[model samples]
Target: MGSINYDDSDVLDVLIVGAGISGINAAYRLHDELPDKKYLILENREQLGGTWDLFKYPGIRSDSDLHTFGYAFKEWTGADIAGGAEILAYLKKVAEDNGIAERIRYKSKVEAADWSTEERCWFVTVNQDGEQKNYRARFLYTCTGYYDYNKVLHAEIPGIKNFKGKVVHPQFWDLKEDDYRGKRVAVIGSGATAITLIPSMANVTKDITLVQRSPTYILSLEKYDPIAKVIRAILPKRMAAFVIRQKNIARIYASFHIFRTFPGVAKAILGRLTKSQLPSDIPLDPHFKPNYNPWDQRLCICPDGDFYTTLREGKAHIATGHIDQVTSNEIILKNGERIPCDIIVTATGLKLSVGGHIKTTVDKKTVDPSERFVWKGSMIEGLPNYALSIGYTNASWTLGSDCTAQYVVRLIKHMDKYHKSSVVPKPSNRDQLTQRPLLDLNSTYVKKAEKDLPKAATSGPWRMRTNYWYDLVQAKYGGYDDLVFA
Candidate 1:
């Protein structure tokens, strides 16, 4: 064991965990709003960009448009749907341009954070380069997002171990080593990853089959927005970006409202659009038609109808059935159909996690997040000077996270103005509040991690809203009288 190093000489004004999009947004806000405050970003990985850096599979692109997903401080003058490498480069440029890159410490994984009432600070334990170190901070911010990075959701398939071919998960894909040229590939799952992989690998592989247990609502969107291009040509760069961003945001809000309010109409429109793109031989009934209404689960997006184009080109096929077993050379379906495959790619899903699985405690008493309630969709109840940067389920992730960053900065400013040392959300009638799931989605991953997540409420600040417009307004001018500040 290495010697534990404690740095008691310096205490950060704010300590942010995870150096991804959320963390980078938070850092920029702090730097711009509170320049005097000391802060640092601790990233567990060797690089930044969080999800963009983690996923290296082929045809990996943003589901949301870059104008809305990109930070408000910067203008994304590229295509709406950008690849993982392009997004990562954008993030790196943001960090470098704003001096955030210097504040980031790579390979620093937060293990535990304990708040001490006596010291009025959080004692954080971290492992850096295989050595344990300790640091103190006046405020703690968790921007780790809501999913597990080290683990992926396991799909159960009988005789998986008996298969002799290569089994790959998108989360752990290595493009350099995994060769698919002229090889028959079968990708399991109908989510975004599978939709992306089939289109991307169709040209290189001999034949690609998309195997799904159930269909998900998928829509085709233009890769480049013509309206955005016209706006950029007419207006100044910053003005154009702002206008385009607002336009995209309104479109997202309107589409979601329509889907939830008029499910039948939305379903019919989606069905018609899908049917038009797909070949006549491939029936829309079994393969494309999803049982659940749109937005019940997240809607998958394929830029420029790439997935459908691949299917129409005879390079890809769709198999909608439950997996019965896996043989050495093929996948056997419960319907007695066997699909030959040289490589099986499991694009199943991610495993949900809260606060990046960091152990949290207050004066040695363990803090179970499931028991606590979220306050203003940013801070957790009964937690001192702590804030969570989570995004919206129905819109671009950065919009909600940016709202959180603004709210946190406001809270910090309020604390500084009143000469307060700490602030915590302490609802008087905590036990009587009705509990709701923090994430409003009904997806498999969200449902599986419900018991491990924090609780929301039916009303007041304890309730969490997925509306980006409402959240933006609240973050800017919401009152904090319900909070306990000292």
Candidate 2:
């Protein structure tokens, strides 16, 4: 309801960039665990809930179960799988309930962050409205997410730019101005956004073209928000929260493990499910098959065969062929077949942001922020009293992020008792060699920042466990004590 005005010259305990899930969680943890500490969160958007607020595409929902995706301190009382708006509302409540709203500076975009070795703090530069301001803090955390603030619009082959139709990217959906009613809309990409948007848009649009470069593994989810409703009725707030988290965590880990240990088994089961849901003619082959294992890039979810049913009824059509180009009135496939559409929706993918894009300079020399290796995906090797809150790739992000926040809180508390100025992640040589992407294989983000990323050790807990169970084991009780601090 109110706000806090701070002078640019003042220094704070922690300065967090990006008010997304990670940044919000970090601020909440800091406020609750160390109430006396000073902190602030800089958000570029007017609202909180970074991704949730940014994406307004139709039929948006969570791919990960809300149970594990939710904050550890707050219970998810809604149905099992929450929609985007519902999730956004829940996040807003989390901030409001914890009095975190006052600490967030809306519309303030951070330009850069420089580490001052002499001052033992970070100098944060932010652009609020039209004014540039500066803030100093002892610690910095980035949660801007991987997407580079750009809508993913792939080239639609030859003559795409000439197309007279309105082209849109899901990341930059405009609900008010863009009208889909009675228009033939072609939604590209087979990922979650395209799958979800296609089914819903079919109801209003004249027809829908579901285009894709390759086929992705599609699965059905529980359509209704059962978890939220059940918790609201029967359980106390705290207990309901705990049960939801535990249940979701168990289910995710169990499923992830089964898929990882037996890829063939997962493929076989999922294959049957897919065939039974869609038409038999739709080829599910090397085109749809991922070069890596399942759960590698995230499986797309369509609750209760909504997407399949939409296609079956003829409101939507799935185009598996490659695109050759876009003309003024139609999309031409590599096979030379042209399909006419009034609007085009591209849901290609998202950019991954690590450490919220904080720029760090040491000794007046710019350290390519992407060059430093990440320690346990949280702390950078050479940075003191700094932590990155990246989450699990397979499981819900909140599961990993919340755990990381708690660990950081505890670590901070431990340091305070000894009057320590910093707590750095000093990994052994073996540990450094073993660190790998939680999910192996070349991802755009991992490959782009590999040189700056910590070399994952091949052995020990630090070796990089893509499995949820292994990560839980390590984050909970294994090898953490070995991280040295001075």
Candidate 3:
């Protein structure tokens, strides 16, 4: 940890926390919109790129296409739909290119932030290099993504500690050469992490056993878009962004509409595809089949049918069952069967919490986030001089976050116009509203954090729709106008 002394005379207009995708974008937009307003971005890590830099597993790439994952203002020029390292570098370059790096205080972790009702400012306490310091800001902005920042873990298997094989979580993958080549590997979970790792590890390892409690429905798309290339050649990069975004959104929407409204049609198409890929005897249970529809819970994308292709080639094996226990060198399935493996990759998934383990307090009183209402998923009820950049659970995260940023800039302009120092969300009936997790969909992160999250007011504006077009209209036109700042 590092520390810096703040001069009391200089009160920051805004304090941005976290240096990840959301934070960087917020800072970049803030400086671009309000160059005269003093703002400081504080990050706990020595480096930026929160999750991308943190996870160093092999074959770590964006689950979504790079076009939507990358910032709206910037273009992703490199290859492979943006892998973890590439994305990390891209974020770093964004900071360096815009001169925002100088404004970032590395290794400065915000220990506490107290809001003052009388003064209408936030008393921020942060630790740096083992030293604690204090500062004050008129507004506070947090972009620290939802997840446990340190050591990601499984839900604690009965005898996990007794396992003798090399047990590793994708979150803490060691980059050094701890060879898994020629070794039997077992990958747990059917999420993006497990699915991606299973097929890829098959080539390196002797064999890979994909252990899944349930099956994940996967869709394939071209890694690089021919149309995107053509558009990039003809139009400016930003213009291409708008066109491509619309095209992708439409494609996803059409696919999902069929899956939801016409289940028979969706099943027929998926059934044929599954039959072509797998043996007829293999069961495709509709129980594990998603209830709502595709794109309801994120539609997992696989380019070139990589996972399917590898499975058919006899390199990888999929095992769907409950693991009874971990043996010294193998896993015991619930059906009195044992599967042996030399290495275990628990892609069991990440724990989700807002702001990455950040604890937020107002006026020195511990605030339950659930008590506040989320207005447009950016402003929290009863909290003044603060804003959050919350991404979409169903759609592209950057798309939604960027949309929120656009709204944030508008809100800032509105505040400036009125010479207002603070803006808070005031709900008509806070207790009467039906509150639920922002996203009730059964993904790992959603399930983890849904219980304690803040809700929307009156369920209409607060009711989050994962639909891109719906959010686009709300963000760009409808819902933003209704928000009262005064």
Candidate 2: Cα lDDT at 146 = 51
Q: What is the TM-score of each predicted model, taking all chains together?
A: 0.97, 0.89, 0.91
**Which of 1 and 2 is ahead in TM-score?**
1
lDDT, residue 278, candidate 2 = 70
RMSD of 2: 3.3
Ordered list by TM-score, greatest first? 1, 3, 2
**Over the full model, what C-alpha lDDT does candidate 2 score relative to the true structure?**
0.73
Off by over 4 Å in 2: 1-9, 150-156, 175-178, 225-237, 280-292, 430-435, 438-462, 465-486
Which of the two, 2 or 3, has more lDDT?
3
Cα RMSDs, all models: 3.5, 3.3, 3.6
Native-structure RMSD, model 3: 3.6
lDDT leaderboard ranking: 1, 3, 2
Pitting candidate 1 against candidate 2, the one with the higher lDDT is 1
lDDT of 3 at 236: 88
Q: What tens-digit string does per-residue lDDT give for candidate 1 at 1-486?
A: 112232433798999999999999999999888887888889999999999999888998888999999999999989899899999999999998887888888899999999999999999999987999887999999999888999998768788887888899998997543489989899999898999989989988998999988898889989999899899999999999999999999999899999999999999999999999998889998898998889888899999999999999999999998899999999999999899998999888888876888899999889988889999888888889999988888999899899999999998999889999999998888778898899888877688888988888988888887788888888989899569999
